[model samples]
Target: MNYFSHNPLNRFSEIRPDTAKMGELWRHEQARVLVVSNNLSLLQAEAREAAFLQQQEAVALANQAEVRVYLGSEGEVPYFALGFAGLPPALLPEAYELHDLRQVALQLPQEQSALLAYARGMVHWNLRHLYCPDCGSLTYSTAAGHVRQCSSEACNKHHFPRTDTAIIVLISEGDACLLGRQKVWQPGMYAVIAGFLEPGETLEQAVAREAEEETGVSLQSIAYHSSQPWPFPSSIMVGFQAVAVNRELQVNYDEMEDARWFTREQIVAGLQNGTLRMPPQFSISFRLIRDWFNQTGAYKLEELVSA
Candidate 1:
């Protein structure tokens, strides 16, 4: 599974509407809160793990939070997420730090990373939707922070959490796959072609569009691979493997720094010599490349990269 895919918490959707039940869960002995501020997650500074606060410690903080969400529960233990408008309540400065979730995701345990991703998404949504778009009125959190309702009685519109959907595809032709790097990315880092899905377009169509726009490669056959929850302000990255119709390249300088077709042998040589750097292992991009690289069983992508 991708890093943030397998969330074990049972998000009790039915119970979200039960305010009394949610309050009870919030006060439960095992209830814990994950605090988020400006999209950064709270972490134990030395341990490099998620900093989950006990109920007593969180109660005062929760009262000042702009948004509080009932994340879900594990058996009897309930999990909640709190989003602060400004700086979150301070823990011991040396003991806790606010870190970008992306930077610390790999260091944390898988389940903790997934749980924090979930919290981040909810907090982001609630914070952004503090006002109703339609009614131009202030909104209030409801449905355990899964929804927002306009305060205006005349335009009481309900808003739900939303995630932007994007397609990331590895365009392959025989022994080679297409990869590209953006100028803002780290030096020597390259990954698959990806872009947001346009309104009214199918996922396959989005894949085809992104490939042509970014790398000028037309796809022959596109197949669904998998998906990963990218909660950097809430987005779901849908993965795909597509066959290139041709090897022709016309890099869009506006969208990409460079695009190229790389054979398996070239990838191995690049990794061995420190010239090529693949995406992080936790990402679907790495999975796409790994699966394609190991198709023949002659070379192990993971071993080559690690070594």
Candidate 2:
């Protein structure tokens, strides 16, 4: 499974509308809260695990939270997320430290990482949509932070959480796959072609378009591979495998620093000699490359990189 896709919570949408029941669950003995400040997750300083506070310990901090979200439940234990513009006064610096989710995701347990990703996405949406787009009025969180309603009696617009969809594809022709690197990325690191899905476009269309625009590699065929819930500020990545029509490269200087077709042997040599680097193992980009390389049975991508 993808890193953030292993969520076990049963998000009971039916019970969100019942304020009394939601409130009861919030105060339940098994209730736990995850805190977010400035889009960074709170982690225990020593253990590096998500800092899940008991309901009693979090009530004071929750009162000051700008976004309070009920992140569903696992059996009888309800999970919630609290977002603040800055660190709450109740937390001590020595006990907890804020870390970017992307940086620490691999270090944390899979389940905790997934839960934190869920919480981060909800908090990001709420914080960004604090005001109504329909009318210039402040909005208040309702439906357990799943919704924001305009405070204006005239507008009364209801807004839900938003997730941007992106298509990431591995474009291959014969024995090689296409990869590109942005100048801003880590030195020597390259990844698959990816772009946000434009309105009025299908996923396959987006994949083909991104490949052509970024690397000038036209696709002959495109196939769905897999998907991953990427919560680096809320986005779902749709993965695909595409066949390229030609090997000619017309690198879009504005979009990427370099783009090239890499054979399995070339990838192994690059990683071994320290001249090339792949994306983090937790990301869909790495998965796409790993799967492609492993298909040949000549080398295991994981063992090559680790060695």
Candidate 3:
């Protein structure tokens, strides 16, 4: 129930969207231009409407570009501009940096982050899946940029945008939640156990499986905490609270570097002054942990700090 305000990284504005895109002719006309980040951060404002109208100017400013629409909530919310690219990995980083599209949402101002993230993720999916996997021929976008269908009649394949489900679980005992640090993580910091959802596994099952696999710590009664639509390419991180069934600590070195339990006292210090530090406030993981403390009524920080 504890929600964060416009805490910069914490903002993921809910823009109730309705996608009316349909038919082949309409898809042909809808812009396939690449949207840039430079425009929204600099020129955008609450009262400013002119910046949203200047679609041509934005295209002209780009070094190399294509024509795409800025899919916004109303007529001109300017969520994120679209770009037309066949293969994103081949693009030059200096001239035009291509991304997974999910990470972009994390970097933006929170108010429009989720909206833009959703738009970009679905669009990116459409870009790559232009051909039917079954027939190896061109496919077209459908469902208002939400789907792709093969052009070949003999091998008609329909593809939908994917959102792989994963869970980030905070394994807690009396005063501690078991945390692990990945090889890629910063020093002195640890976080909840996480993993991808295997075939037919429930969110709770995924949490238990991931925690046991990563740290060899069994979890019981995992409860959903919160969910954030993470775009890193396309993932939905569902945060959870799981009771520690077994206390023995074991680390699966293949998945994690260090895994251990951190007491509430240490968590308090880390939340305030931080050690090697934890996940930034922009991430849903931080919010889950923050809410955990708030639920216990033992700790509460006034500022919805993202750092």
Model 2 Cα displacement at 213 (Å)?
0.7
Estimated TM-score for each candidate? 0.96, 0.97, 0.71
Candidate 2 residue lDDT tens string, 1-307 = 8889888899998888789988999999999999989889988985469898889978887878888999999999999999987875656334778889899888899899999999999999999997899998999989998999999999999999888999999888888999999999999999999999999999998998898889888889999999999878879999999999989999999999999999998999899999999999899999999999899957899888778
Model 3 misplaced stretches (Cα beyond 4 Å): 1-53, 56-72, 75-80, 86-108, 270-274, 295-307
As a TM-score, model 2 comes out at 0.97
Q: By descending lDDT, how would the candidates be arranged?
A: 2, 1, 3
Whole-structure CA lDDT of model 3:
0.57
CA lDDT of each prediction against the hidden true structure = 0.90, 0.90, 0.57
**Best-performing candidate as measured by TM-score:** 2
Measured on C-alpha atoms, candidate 1 has an lDDT of: 0.90
In model 3, how large is the Cα lDDT of residue 255? 86
Report the number of clashing residue pairs per model.
0, 0, 12
